[model samples]
Target: MAEVTYYTEEGLAKLREELQYLKTEGRTKIANAIAEARDKGDLSENAEYDAAKEAQGLHEAKIAKLETVLSTARIIDESNLDTSKVLALSIVKIKNVKNGAVMTYQLVSETEADFKSGKISVKSPIAQGLLGLKVGDIATVSVPAGEMNLEILEISR
Candidate 1:
């Protein structure tokens, strides 16, 4: 069974757009490549044809994976989320317990996570530790670098 993932409206829209592109323009481009490769020479000795077939297989696998994801995706309403504690789609402001350095992150699904844009995956160590925490609550997160303490400063939808 596929695990259901929650996505914001914008994230789901982006995913659908990508799937549509892959089904249309993406498939067309791959089909053209295969056709061109097949016209080159005998199938037995054609490396180009072999490569194109491999690429097509990979592309089809990607489409299948995306379709599965779409089938199990659930759109989350950000406006209805509780601001009292950290949760998925919550924009959380945290302060490092040791150095007092403040940072903000929006907890989102893996597909929507962009570290540079302050969006972190909900499965990440930091976000996992922050989950269910309220403002002023200190969470100890174990990261690859080591263990660190962070205090939840604010939570917003």
Candidate 2:
């Protein structure tokens, strides 16, 4: 069996919305594009038709993948989360021991990981190292660049 993927409430809601859009608006658009391309005549020489068909194929594949992900998604309730130790969905603040730089990240699932939003995947090196750690604990993460030692400054829900 495939591993179950966990998601925060907001992340799960966003996935649902994307799936709906793909089923409704996205499918309709793809159908219209195919129809318009088909109206241009000769199938053997119709570049537009080929492109449209390829696009439809890609769109359908995306929809299928999204549906599968949504079906297996498990939503986590943040209200019930305990911040006593670093864990999935915990907002952790850390300070780099070597550089004295500080950063905060919310550990989430791979699909919800976005560096721009300060969200890191639980599978990531830093998050994996930080998991199960408490405030004042040291996390030594192994990255492609090298090892980075960080001190946990805070942990919050």
Candidate 3:
């Protein structure tokens, strides 16, 4: 069974839009490429045809994977989330215990995680450690660089 992933309404809409594009314009482009390559020469010795076929296979695979993801996707209601502790979609402000560096991040699904936007994946080590922590709670996170301690300063929906 595929694990159900929770996404914000915006995230889910983005996924659906991508799927629609892949099914329509994306597929049409791939078909055109294949047709153009086929028209060039004999299939047996045509590298362009081979490459086009390979690209089509990969594109189809992506579409299949995305379909599976959508099948198990669920939109999370931000307003109903408990703000007492850290959870998915929670905007959290934390301070690094050693350096006193302050940072804020929102825990989101993998598809919606964008470091530039201060959104981190729930599966990330830092986010995993922060889960279930409340305001003023300390979290010890094990990261690729080393172990670090962080204090949760605030949590919000």
Best by TM-score: 3
Error of 1 at 115 (Å): 0.4
TM-score of each: 0.98, 0.94, 0.98
Q: Write the per-residue lDDT of candidate 3 for residues 6-31, one digit (tens) a residue.
A: 99999999999999999999999999
Regions more than 4 Å wrong, model 3: none
Error of 2 at 62 (Å): 1.1
Stretches > 4 Å off in candidate 2: none
State each model's C-alpha RMSD to the native. Answer: 0.7, 1.2, 0.6
- lDDT ranking from best candidate downward: 3, 1, 2
Candidate 3 similarity to native, TM-score: 0.98
Error of 3 at 133 (Å): 0.9
**Candidate 1 residue runs with Cα over 4 Å from true position:** none
Winner of 1 and 3 under TM-score: 3
Q: Using TM-score, rank the candidates from best to worst.
A: 3, 1, 2
**What is candidate 1's CA lDDT for residue 137?**
97
What is the alpha-carbon lDDT for the whole of candidate 2? 0.92
